[model samples]
Target: MLRIMLRHISLLILTLFILSFFSFSLAYLFPGDPLVNLTGIRDSSEQTYALLAQQYAMNDSLFSQYWHYVNNLFSGNWGLSFSSGLPLAEEISRSLAASVELSAYALIISFVIGLPLGFLSGLRHHKFIDYSLLSASVIGYSIPVFWAALIAILLFSVQLGWFPLSGRISLLYDIPYDTGFILIDILLSDVPDKEFAFQDALRHLVLPSVSIAIVTSTIVLRITRRSVVEVMNSEYIQAAYARGLSPRQVFVRHGIKNALIPILPLLVMQFTTLLTNAMIVETIFSWPGIGNGLIQAIYQRDFPAIRAGMLAVSALVLTFTITSDMVIQIFDPARRRPEDATS
Candidate 1:
């Protein structure tokens, strides 16, 4: 286990190093001037321009500039976005909470909606209910994110007025940004109508989260059904059934546990993807998340912010990949060869 973990850590460091270098390289390869973009000022005086350039080590060679940028990155001076004229590090930090909250909510929604449905569909396997559930999942998977988000906002926000049009909470509540997450910050503060404030945050969260959840859940539903079906057909499951155990008892005692072994990695993968795949929903919903920030950075070609966002995403994926692998190996002891300890 130690050997494997060490290998994963080394690989993670190497991957991040490579990603940082390539993402940093985008600044030089892309069109337009990096110095002007960094400062966000198109018409600075000659002296101010010179001073800004010197400050950012823009006069350095490619290697020197990257080294300087990385040094500053470690020190938290992640530079400024040309679009918003805001510190990239601070923007990323702010966006991180919103993105995390949305992703966590989306994952919760997906699992709550998908897992049971998938389990039921699997047990019924070729029956009407199973087929119907499968069909619904297919439809959910096929819906385009941007289109779904727009339709949701129009119907839920405009016509029904059921949910807020955009933003994390209603403007009426003046909840302090204690933790950047509206719900958490609300709880952490002595705000009036605390329950109401929490509910409003949930209301604002539901539209985008549900929109993303639908697609993710569909995948979860299909994969889980397959896993359950496979596990149900196993010899031990059949033996349990033959021993006069109730179907529910057999499922609870043996089937579901085995079925979950394969699904854990899928759940982790889906959760990791939620962190980055939420860009369109965030943009449409006006959620101030990393996804939204990345989109703005892209439009203005804010290279540093774009690079930072990519690194964040890449790191999320890589970390999750390792986590999934470790979790699987831990859950299924068969993968952990006993001889490895001796070697």
Candidate 2:
């Protein structure tokens, strides 16, 4: 396990380095001059451009620039946004919490609804329940996230008036940004009508979250159903049944444990997907998150903000993937053997 973890960590470091290089390079390669965007004066003098370039390290060689970026990144200096003139880290920090909170809610919804539906579908394979769940999963997976979000807003917010149209919380609550996560900030706040504030935040969260959840849940349901069905049909499962164990006992002891091995890693990938999807969902719903911030940065040609956001998201996805691999090795018995360790 230790060896496996160390290997994964090494791979993670390498992956991040590669991701950073591409993200940084792409920012420069993209059509548009960051200097022009920054100065907002297209006909700036060459001297002015030179001075700005030196100040922002734009005059440096690509390799030197990347070295400085990595060094600054390690030292927790994310540089200043070209447009806002604020630290990139600070801007990202403000939006990161919202994205994290939204993703968390979406994951919770996916698991709560997906797991049981999948399990039962597998148990009753080829029956009505299986067919019904499979059909639902297909529909859920097929629906575009943005389309779903729009429909939800129109139905729930426009016509029904059950949820807020956009934003993380009601403008009525002057909730100070403590953790950037509205729910946590609301709970920690000293404001009156705390319950109302929290409820408002949750109401705003529901539409976007459900949009992400619907797509992710379909993935979870399909994987879970396939895994459970495969495990149930295995020879070992049949032997356990032959030993006179109750159906429930056999399932609890053997079926779920084995089935979960595959499901765990898939769930981790699902989380990564959810984070990426959150960007589109955030934009459509007008939710304040890193995704929305990224879009704004792109529109403004804020190179620093764009690079920082991309690096942060790539690092997060890589971290989750590596962590999930380590967890699977720990829990999945088939991978525990010394011979399988290297593999």
Candidate 3:
């Protein structure tokens, strides 16, 4: 197991090394001078732009600058934003909590609703319940996320007036900043200031969260149903049934554990996908997050913000993938041999 982990870790490092160079180059590949773009120096004298570019080190050769960028990253300097002139780390830190909060809520809802429905759908097989669940899954998977989010807002917020139309919270409320997450802040605070803003933020989150959840839940539902069905036919399951164990007992005790082994990797991958989706959803809802920050950075041609955000997202996704792989090795019968356990 240790060897396997070390091998994966090495591969992860290599992958990131390659990815960092490519991500950096792609941002630099665009036409126009970086400093000129930053300063909007079009129509200025060539000498003026040249001086500023040299001052910002943009006049350095691409290879030299890229090598410096890599060295700085290793030395723990992530660089500064061209847009706000703030440290890239600080900008990302400010937005990270909101992005994580949105993704966490969507993931929780996906698993909670998807897993049980999937299990029932698999257990029922050809029955009406199974058909209904499958149909819902298909619809959920087919709908475009942005379209679904807009429709949800139209129906829930516009027609029904049941939820807030946009933004994280009402401007009127005095929301405490213990944590960047509005919901968490509300939970930890006194009730007096929590009324409008807390509820408003939550209501605003629902459409985007549900839109993300619905799309992602399809993958979970389908994978879970298939895995459960396969587990239901395993030798141990048959033996439990032969011993006159109740259907429910056999399903819970003998089936779920085995079925989930294959599902764990996909579950972890779903969180990464949820984060990507949240980018678009956050923009639509005007919720301030890494996605919005990235967009703003891009428009301003801020290389540091782009690189830092890209690196941050890359690190997070890889971390989840590594975690899932480790979990899989632990639970998977084929991988959990004596040799694996000892290693």
Candidate 4:
């Protein structure tokens, strides 16, 4: 078991190393010089441009640049943004809490809504409940995230005025940016006037979060339903049923557990997809998460911010995949020694 875990960790590290290398390489190979782009008023003479590139060490060998970037990454120094004149690390640090909170809420909402529906659909295959759930999943998955977000805004924010249209909080409130997490900051602050600010922040999060959650939940629900049905037809499940076990007991004890073991990996991969989808939703809703931050950084041509944001997201996805693998190994101990378990 320990050996298997070590091998998994090694593979995870190797995968992340390759990801970081390629990401850095692409940034290096992008069109236009960062120095020239930043200066904006510089002459286009070859010698002057060459001198500027050399000054910023862009003229260094590709291998040297990659090594230096990797080294800076290790030392917790992500460098400065060419446009913002702020440290890349600081900018990400300021915005990260909000993104993390949003992502967490989105994931939680997805699982809370997806898992039970999936299980019920699988258990009641061919019934109205199953058909309705399957149909909803298809529609949910097929809709474009931005379109859904815009529609949601039109319905909830425009026509009904049920939720705020933009921003993380209301303008009338004097909520301090205590931790960049509007809800947490509001709760932690002693300001009496901003007591209701937390609820306002949560209300603002609802539309964008639901837009993201719908897509995320659909994927999980479909996967879970498929996995559960597959597990239900397995020999072990049949044997449990033949032994006169209750349907509920067979499902809860045998079917769902084994079904979830396979679904874990898919859920992990979905995190990155969800985050990528959230980028558009965040912009549409004017939410100040990493997705919106990345778009703004690109518009400003801030290389450091762009690189750091991508790297941070890459790390998050990698972490989720690794954690899922570990959980799978724990739940399905037979995978540790497949031959022995099969015999």
Full-model lDDT for every candidate: 0.84, 0.85, 0.80, 0.79
1-343: candidate 3 lDDT, tens digit per residue: 6766776788788888887787667545656765544444568787887786775567688887678767866776776777677777667876877888889899989999889888988898889989999999999999988899899888998999998887787777767767888898887888685666677778878888898898889888998999988899889899999999999999888788888877867787788889888888887777778888888878877766776888877777787777677667766646665767776
Clashes of 4: 0
**Which runs of model 4 end up more than 4 angstroms from their true locations?**
37-61, 173-180, 231-265, 334-343
Model 1 quality (TM-score): 0.91
**TM-score for all predictions?**
0.91, 0.89, 0.85, 0.82
TM-score of 3: 0.85
The CA lDDT at 165 in model 3 is: 82
Return the clash pairs for model 4, or none.
Answer: none
* Residue 5 lDDT (model 3): 74
Model 1 backbone overlap count: 0
Instruction: Sort by lDDT, best first.
Output: 2, 1, 3, 4
Q: lDDT per residue, candidate 1, 1-343, as tens digits? A: 6766676678878987898888777766777677765656678899999998899888889888889878987998887777777787788878877898898888999999999999999999999999999999999999987788899999999999999989888889998776777788998999899999999988999999988888899998999999999999999999999999998899999988899987867787887767765766899898989888888878877777888888777776787787677666656566666764444
Backbone clash tally (model 2): 0
Residue pairs that clash (backbone atoms under 3 angstroms), model 2: none
After TM-score superposition, the amount by which residue 305's alpha carbon in candidate 4 deviates from its true location, in angstroms, is 2.1
Best by TM-score: 1
